[model samples]
Target: MCVKCDNCGAEIGLDGVCKFCGTVLPPREPVAPPPVAPGWGTPPPRPVFSIPQPRVPVQQPVQAASPKSRWVAILLWLLLGYLGAHQFYAGKVGMGILYLFTFGLCGIGWVIDGVSLFAGSFRDRYGLPIRV
Candidate 1:
């Protein structure tokens, strides 16, 4: 009789070790008897009925924005974003100046802007998407 691997359950030889699952059978345990009440035969297997269906197609926006790469923005942010260097690079001179004076809106504005920019919700001063 063939036996399944004790770990991965792949079919293995009746004796020795299993190469497919790489499990060494230390020792076999004593087989237990079934708990049926003597007269009943084994119950029928459960039925599988549902047919597989195709997955739904994902929808994407048709129009795309042309702006600078997300890395440049993130780089400027890392280097001088607190002083609005990233905003200046993105052509938002006013906000850049404001950020320079206000310390990136006292850190609150940049935190929100960082999340929005990374999440694809942020746009440039010219209303172009930041290609994240």
Candidate 2:
């Protein structure tokens, strides 16, 4: 025997099911949709956004002054610069030898060394500035 499906209205065989629609012999109760909350028709509010700010760099602490004296180096450069006395005092042996041989690069290097010594930019063997 054959019967019609209650859900799809298709014909079924003796197994009590619809062949075309796959519906059972007896139809189940219809399911109702969930109830909507109040004001569900309105869309949600948009999210707020803000731009970031640039940050300032922090200042570093000052280093300790060198133990070598600037006045002593200046005096050596003034008196015996052609002989590289100031370079020897600053512990720059190679420059001292060069100055000793070349007469301070024909006196030009001697003048520049004196300028650097007075400007507080001359360094020692350890690379520390002889600013003191």
Q: What is the lDDT of candidate 1?
A: 0.82
Off by over 4 Å in 1: 1-61
lDDT of 1 by residue, 1-132 (tens): 677887888877766578787787877787898678865987767998998899999899776774577888888887888899888888899999999999999998778778877787667888888885
- Every model's TM-score: 0.51, 0.56
The residue-by-residue lDDT of candidate 2 on 4-66, one tens digit each, is 677787787777677888766655466797877888866678898987888878889887666
User: Model 2 Cα RMSD, Å?
Assistant: 10.2
Cα lDDT listed for each candidate: 0.82, 0.85
